[model samples]
Target chain A: MAQVILKRIASGDKSAVQDCLKTYGGLIWSLARRMSPNPEEAEDAVQEIFIDIWKNAARFDETQASETTFVAMIARRRLIDRLRKINRQPNVDSLEDVLVEPTNDREQDLQVCVEAREAAAAMKNLRPEQRQILHLSIIQGFSHQEIADALKMPLGTVKTHARRGLIQVREFLGLGSDFEKEATV
Target chain B: MKDLQDNRLVELLADQSFFGLSAEEGMELGQLKKRFPEWENDFSLELTAAAIGLANLDVREDLPANLRAQVYANADEFFSEGATDQEVFNFAPSANKTIVSPPGASVAETTSGFSFWQNLGWAFAAVAGIALAVNIWTTRFEKPSEVVKNPETIQMPKPELTTAQKRDELLASAKDAVQISLTNPKNEKEIVGDMVWSNEKQRGYARFRGLPANDAAKETYQVWIVDETQDSKTPISGGVFDVDGSGEIIVPINAQLAVKKPKAVAITKEKVGGVVVSKQENVVAIAKV
Candidate 1:
């Protein structure tokens, strides 16, 4: 039974801050670099991301998601907000490049987190086009239009694939029912 | 129809989670939110993307050493005892320069030292305010004063004192004044300034030699007085001012609320007109009491 870093951070445990930085710094740094338009913005984003992490630490519930998933989720939210504020899109690979490459180049490192492993397994259930669209849009930070243009597909079709792919993943991760229960309540 | 709309809501949420929404889609989502308010906090796609992104993260490059230190420094301040939860923040100080009151001066000596300085506040305010009002009224309604014989006799005007001079006079006179140098904690370039406060007078002033000027349209400098009387998290805002020029400048502290025993004064760059509570991310300079 390991201590939840976020819970400790919420309680103002100084050592937990150190542990959090050590554990999630790389993940967040990578996300920021990929999502922000420039290094300076990335640096600022990281600082603000950590602040958001601390502010939202008390809300971290281990039962809902793994620590890695929770940290990544928080980082994504801030990065997305920053992107919207600046009205700039992330630098993304051309659709052809994404299509030709190995889908899971870092698959070996996927075992580092339970949620990642589960997500990787769940991604296999989507249709090939849906999986590719999700990878381009979600993992590579491409917009729906960008993905549609890159893939030479209709925008509506791209949106459908992305939405269905995410729904499939949500179900695979056993989140759909919980979400439904919460929504109905 | 209900099922189709529910699906549309899910589509919008999933799209928003992935790459945000276009203006039209955002409006649609806002309308749908009214229909399905339960999904307001729903972040399933975001969580899915994060999980998938975690599996795909290629460069888990460690944070730069300098950046790591900054994160720790920020945490120290964010979690500092009695620090308020400010969503907006400024910079930090690399070094603290505290100038305490000179050794063992009695209340009698300090009180005598401030006699001229104490009266100056009242005299200066009354003269300036009344004179300006009179000047404006006379110029607008009546003929201006154009006397020839002894112009100086009609208006016995004292020389206007610059803010720097006022600050200097206060420093020379107030024996209990605490002066602390303010600096940028995270950067190499030094932000030169000193914040001075007198516990006896409950007055303070800030002087900066080379602080950068700010755009009032975008942001302004806000002063904060951290004291023992109130929670450190919600330090009294000492009012907002702008640096419209390049050289040395002095600003009078107009603490919107009184502080009894101030432990520190800080200046943060904030949105135009300043914020009621700062997040402190943009704190440019700080002086410890």
Candidate 2:
């Protein structure tokens, strides 16, 4: 019901920058801290990410994705690029280390909150191994080899679980079949 | 109508939305979209599903107030310079320190009230000053021999070549190596690559030109060494790697087990690390030996 912060920033309102920081600074900082290897690097990355966000503000399409999702997408792109540049290897952590069962207390858009809740609920239905693979892939940003090393599972088994887990999650969200028809509009 | 091909397409879409689509898969996806527009919807849904999955991970911690102030100041400075917002990205922390300005100033009324000649002279002076400063800084702080002797002092190390470089080196030195083309059956010419291996050396390299850079977090392309002489049907694991960029990637063959009589080398899209045995459902390219 309110004008999106990105739209205001795109219109060259300097005050919107403050408003955006108040709203999403924590979200971006948390993500940067998680992705960056060190605090200084994280601080620098956060600065660059805000600059990127400013430049890309005009391109945000709320119809396609929520504001938080859009911001997350941009943040990940920058953070991942930094990660690749440094060739920093992440420690392989077992699935138990990463997966946090979603709680309903957080404040977010209703639709977004619903989707997150659905994904969390669906995760409960998955086999422990499948859930582990999904968590590593989705949350921790580990490659399959890292997962194999961390879990001591066969590489083939990891792929099987990843493929099956994603498919099952999609189904559980009621998006497996007839998903195309719902998405295009 | 929706069979194995549909399932494969769905898997490819999933990979594309979560990580990235390989160039070969991208081509296949493009064709599928053109032929079957409904596939676009499927792709969109998959992307949404990935975003939703990510939403569960959102746990926020407030940014330090100083960092927020820094961001606000940077943005204000960037906007106040009368330069377009996008130009702010051109300011690198290291290297040239020129503040970029908008082009096309009237010759008669240059800002700062400096005439053309004065501005030109000042620019030359600035360049000379910068050069002298750099020389002094480098000589005083970083002696070349000392830096070489004690590399740890450098805050940021130079980027090393990725695994692709190692693969390229292996291919370059391989003896008696044969080159074979990897082709897809559906779109044979569109998605193709070359694999060079030396049977005697028991080593090889795969050079794929069109594979998209994969998101290391989601999926990776796995190489398989098809050895028929081993008395087993399972292809030897040739290690796992992800494409970092679009264009030819030369990856060294890392065979888990020894390769006896070589039949062929195949590549399949697998989960990030790779799989022990491939189901072969998403074989992007195959180079027969």
lDDT at B88 for candidate 1? 14
How do the residues A136-171 of candidate 2 rate in per-residue lDDT, one tens digit apiece? 665555556567776778976876787777777766
What tens-digit string does per-residue lDDT give for candidate 1 at B122-240?
A: 34434444344223222222223543442432332223345677677668778987888877766525757888777655556888877788987888888888877655566767767
Give one digit per residue, the lDDT tens place, for model 1 in A138-175.
66566787677667789999988887788778778876
TM-score per candidate, in order? 0.53, 0.45
Could you give the CAPRI-style class of model 1? incorrect
Error of 1 at A66 (Å): 0.8
Tell me the spans in candidate 2 whose CA falls farther than 4 Å from its real position: A1-3, A10-14, A55-59, A86-112, A152-157, A167-185, B1-13, B16-60, B73-289
Off by over 4 Å in 1: A1-3, A85-98, A103-106, A178-185, B1-4, B22-37, B81-289
Considering the true interface contacts (CA pairs under 8 Å between chains A and B), give the fraction that model 1 also has.
0.45
C-alpha local distance difference test of each model: 0.65, 0.59
Interface RMSD of each: 18.5, 13.4
Worst 10 residues of 1 chain B by lDDT: B93-102
